[model samples]
Target: MKTRAAEGGTGGVRRRPTLLSNAETWAQLAVAARIGPEAYAAVGTAAEPGTVLLTVNRPGPGPVVVEAPFGTRLGDVLHACGLRPGDSVLVGGYHGAWLGPVDAAGASLSRTGLAELGATLGAGAIVALPAVTCPLGEITRVAAWLAGESAGQCGPCRRGLPDAADALVALATGAGGPAGLEDVRRALGGAQGGGACSHPDGTARFVLSALDVFAPDVEAHIAGPGCGRPVLGVLPLPRGEGARLEVDWSRCAGHGLCGVLAPGLVRLGPHGYPASTTIPVAPWQEHGARRAVSQCPALALRMRRPERGPGRLR
Candidate 1:
C-alpha cells in the first residue's frame, strides 16, 4: 500500500512536504495567471468557469490530450477525437464511468453535466470504444488490471477486487451466465465503503458504469450467441516494466505462505494456493514481498524485474 505523507511537524520532527496537485492543475494555474481570472472565467459556463485538459482516446490514432472549455458537448469532443457520437465512451479514466450512446449524445464535459448523466468528469479522460473491438472483453481486461493494481492494504483490495475481476472474466467469456453478472454487482457492492482509500469506490464506479453502458452486449453474451468479435487491446495500461511477484507452480506446494506474508498482493484460492501467479508489487510492498520470497518453503516465489525500458501507453 502507498503511504501518504502526513502534513505538519509531530514531536518536533519536520516531515518533507508533499505537493498533492498534478501537472494539469499546475498548467491550469499558469493559464489562469497569464489570461487573468476574469478572462478565464468568461469562456466556460458560470458553474464551471475554466477550460479543462482531456486525454482523448479513440480508434486508429494514438491518445491525444486537448484542452476544451467546460460544458462543451460530449459529442463534439468525440467528433474532434475521430469518433462518432454513438460510440461507447469511457469517461474520466480507469476509475471512471462508461457512457452509452444516448448518454454520450447529450452529455457535456463539465462535472455537473456528467453528474446529471450519473457519471463524473474524473481526470478528464475520454475513451471511445471502436466498433471493431468487443466491449465486454475490453471491460474485463481493465477490471483484471485494476485488480492487479490494488494496494492490498484493505479487505476490499485483497478480496473484493479479485473476485470482481473473476466474475467479469466469466461474463466476458460467455461462461458466467445471468448469475455471473449478479456476482459482479455483488462483489462491487461488497467493496464499497470498505476501504480507507477511494480505490475500491472508484473501481466500483468504473465497472458498474461498464455494466450499464454495455447492457445490450452483456445480454447478448448471457442470453444468446456471444458477440464473436475479438478483443483488440485498444485500452492503454500502465506499462508493464516494473518489479512483480511470480510463482513457480511446478516447484511449488500449496503452502499459502505468500498470502500470509503479502496479503495485499497474494490471495489464497479454495485450495489454499496463491490465486494469481503474476502479482503487481507496489513500491511500499517490496519489503514484504522480499520476505515472502525468501521464506517460501518450496522456493516457489520469485521477484522478476524486467530489463526493458518503460513503455508508453496509447
Candidate 2:
C-alpha cells in the first residue's frame, strides 16, 4: 500500500488538512479558474458548469474513463463508454449506489439529477456490474475491504465493521440465515455514528441500497443455497481498525447485565464481581459488545481507543 505524510493529523476523518474534494472536482476548478466561469459554462449545464471524469469498473474498452458534461444523460455516458445490455451501472465510486438498465436509461449525471433517484454523483466514477456476477458476493468483498480500512478511532467502527462484512459473506455463501441479515443490519447501524469519518455511513448506504435495488436477488439467495454466480470482484477495495470497552469498577455495580446480554464478549467475575474490567471487542462483535457496555446499570463503561496505530487489529 502507498503511504504519504498526512496533511492533517494522523487521526480522525478528513485526515488531510487540504480542502479535499475529488481530484476531478479540483481539476474542474482549476480549469474554470484558468478560463473563467463564463467560458467554462459554454459546454456544460448552467447550474453546474463543469465536466466529470467518469471511470468504469473493468479493464474493457467500455470501462475507460471519459470526460462528460454535467447535464449529460447517464445513458449517453454509458453508451459512449460501451455499456452493454443488462449491465448495471454503479454511479459514484465504491460507496456509490448502482443503477439497473431501466434506471440508468433515464438517469442523468448531474448532482441534482442523481439526487432525484436518491443517488449521488460522488467522485464521478461509474462501474458497470455485469449481470453474470453474483451481486451479493461482489458486495461482500467490498464490505470486507471497507472493514479492513478503519482508522481504529471510534467504538462501533473498529468493532462492528468486521461483523457487517462477515454477515455479507455468509449471506453470499448462503450460510447466513435471515438472522445473519439482521446481524448485518445491526452491525451497519452500530458503525454509522460516532466515527471519525463517514466510512461506515457511506458503506452502509451502499449495502442497504443494494438490499433495496436487488431485493429479488437478495430474496432468491435467502431462499436458495447460493446465487450460483461468481463474485467477479467488479468493485475495488483498498485494504483498511478502532477501540476497546472498559468499565470503571468504582461506578460499576457488577449488575452482571452486560454478561447476560453479550456473554460472548463480557463475563462476570466470581459472584458477579465484574472482576475483568476490560472487554476487547472484535470488529464482528461490535453491536452486542456495545450493548453490553451501554446496558450496564452502573453506567461505568467507556470506549478506549489506542493513542496511536492499531492495537489488536494490527
Candidate 3:
C-alpha cells in the first residue's frame, strides 16, 4: 500500500496479505523476514501512512492466523492453548474481569472482553481461573464494584445495580434463597440495557454470565444449602475497600415494608422482604438511597456507596 505522510513528507509503501483471505500470510512471509508486499491498495489521500499495524496470534497448536492487533488478549491466547473447558477467564483491560469455563472451543475472545472483563485487546484477552475460587462470589464482588462505577445518569442503572449486588452478596454468603433469586431477576430487568453507556449492561452481563457458568453454585444456593466453601476473590478488582450494604436475613422477617417505601429502589420478593436493585446509586440520589436505607423496619437494609471516585468502581 502506497500512502503519503505529513505535509511534504512521502509516506512509506507497505505490503501485506489479508489474513482472513490468506491464513498463512505470516507463516509464508515469516515475522522475522518482514518482506511481504502490499496486498491491497491504500485508501485516504495518501498523505498519511495510516497507523501502525499489529498482528496478534491466537495461541494454538495449529496454523497461526493474525488478528488485527498483534498482541491479542493474553487470557484468550491461553484458552486457545487448551486451558481446561469451563475455565473462567478475565477479559477487558485490568478493570474488566469475568469467570467462565471455555465453553465454546472456537469462541473468539473479542466481544467477551468488555461485557465480562472491563478490558478487551480488540481481539482476545487474558484468561485464568483456579479451582479453589468460587466463581459466584468473585462475580458478586465484581458486580458490586461495577455498580458503584456507574455514572448514575439513568434511573434504572443508578437504582438497580446495588440491589443486584446485594442479592449476589446474599447468595454468596449463604443468606439468600428463592426470594433473592427473584430479586436478581428484577434488578437485571430494571438496570440492564437502560443506561446511555454500557455500565448497566456490563454489570448485567457479568451477573448473567455467572448464572450460566456457576449453575452448580446457584443450584446449591437455591436448595437453601451452602456451597461449603469460602469466597476466594480470584478475579482482580480495584484495590482498597468499598462501601457496602448489609442485609440481616435473620432480622428481615419478610415484612415486605421496604418495597413500599421505595418502589423504584426496592422490590418485594416472593417471601415478602424487600429486595434491592442492582443499579449503582448515583451521586444525586444519595439522599433517596439514605432514606430507603433508614426506613427499613427490619433494619436489614443498608447502602454502601464507595468513598473513592471512578477508579474505585472499576
Candidate 4:
C-alpha cells in the first residue's frame, strides 16, 4: 500500500516504505493480521468482507457502538439498539437519506443492499428518529445546518443552498404555501452539481430523500394545518464542543438583522442593539444563529467556538 506522503513530503521512493491508511482501515487490517485473512473473510459477505463498527442511535440517552457483520439486516441492527421495526430512521448521517418504516425495515447493512434502497452505509451511523418529533422539522433543521456549512467558494454553496434551505424553512413553517415544494425543487436543482466540493450535491440528495420519505408530512405542512409536533432537536450535533454568537458592540450599527434572523435566540432592545453581546445558541438554533451572523450588515456578529480544555494524557 504505497502512501502519498509520510510525515513530510512524499518520501522519495525507497526500497522499503511505510504503508498508510485511515485509523479504521489500519485497525481492521490489524484484526485481519491477528486472525488471518481466511478467518476474517468467514464473517461478512464475500464482497464486503469482515465486520463493520456501527454507531447506533435509537430513542435512547446515548449512542451505542456495535460491531456487526456487513450483510446484517438494518432491522435486526435497530432491534438490537432497542428500536422497533417500521420506525423512521436516518440512514447514514446528515448527508444521508431518510428511510421510512418500510424501507428501513427491509434495508440491509451492506453497501450494495443499502444502495438498492437509495442509501449508503456512510460511517455506519444509524439513527432511529423518535415519533414524538416532527420528521420534516428534523430535516429542515439539518438542511439549515448543511446550508450554513457551505464554504461559499462556489455558486451552489454561496447562493443555491441557502435559498433552498430558506425554502425548506418556509415549507416547514407552512409559510411557503402551495409554492413551497416548487421553490425547494428549483433551488435543489440549481444546487445539485458543478460545485467546488460535494456539499451542494450531498445536501440536495439529503433534502430530496427527506421530501420523498416524509411526503405525507410535507403535504400536511404545505396544504393542511400542521403535524403539531415540535422540533425536539433529537438528532445529535457536535455543539457540545462549545459554540456561541458574539456581537461586537463597537462594530454594530444596530442593524437589527440578527434579531430578525434568529428572533428567538436574539432579541432587539428599544435602542435596536442586541439585548446581550453574547448569545448562547442551541444546536437547533445554530443554523439561524449562523444566518444572523452572515446577514448582519455591519459584520458585528461572529460565531465563537470555544477552545476545548486539554484532557489529561496518560
Candidate 5:
C-alpha cells in the first residue's frame, strides 16, 4: 500500500497518521498499531507502515495483497485472493454469514456482487468460516443485534426485529422448539422488505441466510435446541444515531390510518403492515404528522429529525 501525507494550507506538510488498508485488514491493523511494537512483539505480530494485512480463513503459503477491481464485492475480493467456487464464504462481517460453500466463480465483491448472492458487502466485510463453526448460531446472533439496532422508526422493524431476535436467541440458547422457529419464520417473513429504510430487509436477509446455510442447525434447534454455544457477535453496526421516524402498525391494523393521516408519507404493505411512501411529509404537514404519532394505539410510531453537524444528516 502507498502512504499519503496531508499538506496544510499554510505551506506546511504533515504525514497522515493513519494507514490505508482494506476494511477488514485496516480494523485489525488499527488495534495492533495502537499498542506499539512491544505489545505487538508480545503477540508475535509486527506492523509494517505501508504493508496491508488481510484475514483470510484459508490463506496461501505466501505474501499477497489483493488488488480488487473497482466495484468489487466482498465475495469478489475473496476470489481475487484465490477463494474458489463452492468454498465456504462468510458474508456481512462476523455477525454476517456462517453458511455453505458459495460459488465464488459467480459471486462479485461489490454491493452488486453480494446482492447477487442474496447478501450485501456491508462495509465491504467478508470472512470465511470453517465448517466447524455453527452457521445457524452465527446468523441467529446477528439477527438479534440487527433487531436491537432498530431506530424504532417503522412499526415492523421496531416490533418485528426484537421479536425475531428473541426467537433466534431462544434457538441459540437451546430453549426454543419448532413453534419457536415458526415464530422466527413469522417474524422474518413479516419484517422482510418492510421498513422505511433497508434495516428490516437486511435483518431478514441475515436470518434467511442462517436458515439457508444452517438448515441442519434450524432442524436441530427445532427438534430441540442441540447446539451448546454462546452466540458470538461478528457483524458491524452503523456508528452513532441514525435517521428516525414514527409509525404505528397497531392503531393502523391495516386500517391505513397513516396513509389516510399522511397520504404522501405512508402506504399499506401487502401483509397489512404500514409501509412508508417515498414522498416525505411536506414541512406544512409536521403538525398533522405529530397528531398521527400521538394517535397510534400500538404505540408503534415516532418522528425524529437527525442531529446536525459537519456531514451530519440535514
Candidate 6:
C-alpha cells in the first residue's frame, strides 16, 4: 500500500512498491525542475529537452564532463573539443558501444539519436580510444571488472564473466589462440539468459559491441603475438582488487593435488600448499588445470573463468 522511490519514498526500506531511477536520471530530473521547461526546451530538441553531461576523453588537457544540447551531433561536439576528423569514438561508456567516425558523423546526443546507431546514453559518457593503446586490452579489463562486480548468484555470470575475461587476457598477452574467441562468443551466448537482474544482459551488450567495433584488433590479437601495444588501462572500473582466480583458503589442506595436476602453473610449497602467481591458465594448459581442479583432495583451488564475453558490433 506504500511506495518507495529509492530516496526512502512513501514507505520505509524493503516496502512492496518501489521505483528506482539511475543516478543520472535523478540528477537530470533535478536539473529540469530547476531550469523550468521553456528554458530547457530552448536548448534541446522538441522530443527531448535540456542538456546532457558528457565525460569527454581525448589526447588533451581534459576529460571534463560538458553539458551539451540533446540533439547535437557527436562529431561536431568532438571537433569543438579538439578531436581530429578521423579519430574513432566509443559511446555509452564501458557499458556502451563503439562508434566509428562515420557512425558518429552526424549522430545526435539524444536517446532517439543514439538508438538509431544501436546505442543508448548509458551513464552518459564517451571515450576516444587513441591510436596508441591496445583497445583489446582495455575491453578485457572492463570485462574482468564487470565479472568481479557480479554477486556470483547466477550460473552464467559465475562462469561466463571470468571466461570472457580470461580470453581477453589471453588474446592480449599472446597466449590465446583461435579457441579464445570461440570460448568468448560461446560464453556470451550462454550467459545472455537467466539472471536475477539485468547486469548480465547489459554487460553482454557492452562487451559484444566492442567485439564488433574492434574486429581488426581482435583478429590481430588472435592471429599472432598480440597487437604490438600494451593495455593502457583506459577503461575505468571500481578500485579494489580486479577479478582473480580465488581459492577457498579454509578448505585447502595442502594435498599437493593441484601442483601434480598443473605442474607448470600450480606449484606446491614445502607444506604441500598450492600456490599460484598472478598468471592465468594458458590455452594449451587449461585442460590440465581443469583436471587438477576436479581431482583436488581439498577442493580449494577456484579459478575464475571469463564469462566476460562480447558479440559483434563494429
Best TM-score goes to which candidate? 1
TM-score of each: 0.76, 0.67, 0.55, 0.74, 0.48, 0.70
Q: CA lDDT, every prediction? A: 0.82, 0.71, 0.56, 0.78, 0.55, 0.71
Better of 3 and 4 by lDDT: 4
Which candidate, 3 or 5, would have the higher TM-score against the true structure? 3
- What TM-score does structure 1 among the candidates reach? 0.76
Alpha-carbon deviation at 181 in model 1, angstroms = 0.9
The residue-by-residue lDDT of candidate 4 on 110-220, one tens digit each, is 889889988878777878877788888888777766765666677887667767776787788887777988889898899887789888888887889888888888899
Candidate 5 local lDDT, 1-314, one digit each (tens): 43343432233235334444566676656766897745544532132222223344443353244544334334555666675423256655543443356454356445554565666545434556444455566666456446546566777775677667666766666666777778788987887777898778777766767676667767876676565544443233343333334554344465555546754344445565664412233344466567667775566667765466532543
- Best-first order by lDDT: 1, 4, 6, 2, 3, 5
TM-score attained by model 6: 0.70
Report per-prediction Cα RMSD to one decimal: 5.8, 10.9, 10.9, 7.6, 13.6, 9.4
Candidate 3 residue lDDT tens string, 176-222: 77777778878888886777877776667657755766778787877
The global Cα lDDT (0 to 1) of model 6 is 0.71
User: Candidate 1 — which pairs collide?
Assistant: none
- lDDT tens digits, residue span 49-68, model 1: 88889998855668889889
Report how far off residue 258 is in candidate 2 (Å).
20
Top lDDT model: 1
Over the stretch 1-314, how does candidate 2's per-residue lDDT look in tens digits? 12233543464346543344556667788898999978899976878777877776564543577888888888887677676535567788767877777887788789988988878888777777778888888787677666656666776666677668767766777766777678788888887765788887877777877777776777777888776887766676522234556788789776788777765456465678543455545565577777876777888887665555433332
Q: Count the backbone clashes (under 3 Å) in each candidate.
A: 0, 5, 36, 0, 14, 19
lDDT, residue 159, candidate 1: 78
Decoy 2 TM-score against native: 0.67
lDDT of 3: 0.56
